[model samples]
Target: MKSTSTLLAPEEEFPTALSELPVLEIHVLHSRVCRQLDHEYLTDPAGAHPVTLDRHHELVAELDDRDAA
Candidate 1:
């Protein structure tokens, strides 16, 4: 598949591609990692941006729930 990143202008994006191994499952695996981190590690971790962390956790939860259904 052509990379969607190429649709962006050169200056607006960096080079990236879906790696060969398990490209189809990357989203599921990545979400599991984020959910683990959100629940187990990132709560008020020192020197981090609290607002950004909160937003990330919210997104992770939403995705996880959608996938679980």
Candidate 2:
């Protein structure tokens, strides 16, 4: 799949890390991860990838930090 970042100019490249993403981007990613987890839960209730869960936790922490600020 083509990333939207490809359309950006050289000066407008997307950040490579979750911590570097803007709040809006973080929210979008967080929501996408949640949907993936929900799908996994429906398909295999006994298994959800630890990496994905870790990412969700990271995004949540970033959001929480932003809110506290």
Candidate with the greatest TM-score versus the true structure: 2
Clashing pairs in 2: none
RMSD of each: 10.5, 7.6
lDDT of 1: 0.41
Kindly list the per-residue Cα lDDT of model 1 for residues 2-41, writing each as its tens digit.
Answer: 3333122212322133243243444543444355445444
**TM-score for each of the candidates:** 0.33, 0.71
Model 1: weakest 10-residue lDDT segment is 6-15
**Model 2 CA lDDT for position 23:** 81
Clashes of each: 0, 0
